[model samples]
Target: MKNESQIFGIRAVIEAINSGKTIDKLFIQKGLTGELSKELMDLLKKGNISFSYVPIEKLNRLTRKNHQGVVAHIAPIAFHNLENLTLKVIESGETPLFLILDQLSDVRNFGAIIRTAECTGVHGIIIQKKGGAPVSADTVKTSAGAIFKIPICKVDHIKDAMFYLQASGIQIVAATEKASCPIYDIDLTPPTAIVMGSEGKGISNSVLKITDHMAKLPMYGEIASLNVSVACGVFLYESIRQRL
Candidate 1:
């Protein structure tokens, strides 16, 4: 994920996907109506490629080219398979520490969290293919090259990823705003993966369904919540402290 590059347009993206390149997600103008757009949507659905339907203005901001009302960002690093990574960690006789981003869209926050996860010996990071931040140059700079070292896996859906992790004997602990149990009270020594949500909304409903433990940070101030990255740091460090 260290190298930086730009990928644009619909046909180009489709080719990238077909070529087995890892794409973060595709963005299509919200109101697009035509045969080509329709075909692209069908193709994405069939391939389990996640995409966002955004306003034309959003697409325009990305590039001035005839973009064909579509744009896809390539992930800076190649994503690993969840099953393989989980098995590898277990085979190494290590407690698996994984981080899942439910729908985090902030690039800097994503990078900072990745940096913390890597430093803390997390085994892998799982993020939804859509609605998550793309690993752009900003992310690499924010992480200071940590993104290059850590393993990241993109799943078609976060809920599905959670289920897979749970099946692999990894406990799914959610860092949420709604939980009554503070993160400090949780037992993190088990094979565990902590789930973080976006700044605008906490963990999505689908992901919340499969979480084994729900933990929240203790906040006494007027502010209702901590920044996503700050919350991630607190949760990850707590796990590190417990393991030590």
Candidate 2:
């Protein structure tokens, strides 16, 4: 995936977002007192774009330009729509394997999961646009370039993506410590979509309610949980095992 093209001017960024370009993340200089800046902010608020308010130093580091106190990093990967990607997978003569990240924020974890997903032959990955890590330099580095080869779909909401997957005959499985069934027990050979949550919290109740199965990794150790990325690898490999 190509790195997102940077647009520094406030109006240029606002126009790009308005024109339906996927902005990876926006950096707005803190404490701007200009009418154009205020107008740009209003557009961001209306569009519900995710952005960080940072000091001018950060903006300068991004570019030596007078950035007008604004810069939006375009998405490195051209994100496909969830429904379209799901349909393409169904038509591709293979079982659809999807990894859905629920509010997972760590860049390393995100990248590691992408690596595992790509190696395991997951057809696509679905992530909520807001809570997941944006494709940054560190994510690309951590993924070891796997991010470039995988198809990542950014959705408006997790629940909506789940509905689309289910409608397309994809089983939604939640991998968490709270599941009654062990991951090894679930039949992952079918067309399946596995949902992994953030490190701090497991899958949200709103999403868990809609899952077709809830499976947990069996543990026999003092520490009750595993790192989110490691847990993801276990679930993904289990699916590969079942498929074999």
Candidate 3:
């Protein structure tokens, strides 16, 4: 049997799409041309799924078996609907607490945040489609199965999700070192979604510009930064403390 984590070959990938598999991303051979490749490309565009064409060597590196110019990475768990999830949280008389991960590419950090979000009763976790880490086996293991317990939404853009959440009366707060106010000082008990950026570049400028509040964690040591997951844990636990 083929690996559940990867769908290789053109026909197999097309079948997976038709069968409603949760495909995280597709990598195709650059300049690949044929009726089959054209059909796959058309299907991808129709579904609004993203794909990238790379050199054949890249595809070969990902899989030794015959990939037939395409390889699709499958999401570990099915994604949840953000609109339905947000509405449900509000209707149930629970303040919606969402965790928005912006372009985070580290599997371990992503998993750690999922584990923390589940423990803190976060309504759901949102990840951008393009740059976020795929929910693969390593992520599932690092999360200790918390990835299965929590609701996760994969959106095309984090900014679009931010706008929707804002319109629904959810305050968008970002955790960045540049903010003057400490994370503990933010009013996190309200319907809120905490946006944590990647460790490398921090939050994107576009998303940061629209936030309702910007807060930072205290730094005492010579090191001015914390691991993304560790920072996320601190922010989450503080919110939990305030809500109690």
Tell me which of candidates 1 and 2 scores higher on lDDT: 2
**Deviation in Å, model 3, residue 197 alpha carbon:** 0.7
- Local distance difference test, each candidate: 0.85, 0.87, 0.92
Q: Candidate 3, TM-score vs. the true structure?
A: 0.96
Lowest summed-lDDT stretch of 10 residues in model 3?
1-10
Clashes of each: 1, 0, 0
How close is every model to the real structure, measured as TM-score? 0.86, 0.83, 0.96
Per-residue C-alpha lDDT of model 1 across residues 173-199, encoded as one tens digit per residue: 999878989999999999999999998
RMSD to truth, every model:
3.3, 3.9, 1.6
Candidate 2: where are CA atoms >4 Å away?
A: 1-9, 15-21, 27-71
lDDT of prediction 3: 0.92
- In candidate 3, the residue pairs with backbone N, CA or C atoms under 3 Å apart (3 or more residues apart, or in different chains) clash, namely none
Candidate 1 displacement at residue 75 in angstroms: 2.0
The top-ranked prediction according to TM-score is: 3
- Angstrom error at residue 185, model 2: 1.1
Model 2, residue 177: C-alpha shift (Å): 0.5
lDDT of 3 by residue, 1-244 (tens): 3456988999999999999988987899988899998999999999888887889998888889999999989887899989999999999999889999999989999999999999999999999878788898889989999999999998988999999999999999999987999987799989999999997999988999999999999899999899999999999999999999
Clashing pairs in 2: none
lDDT of 1: 0.85
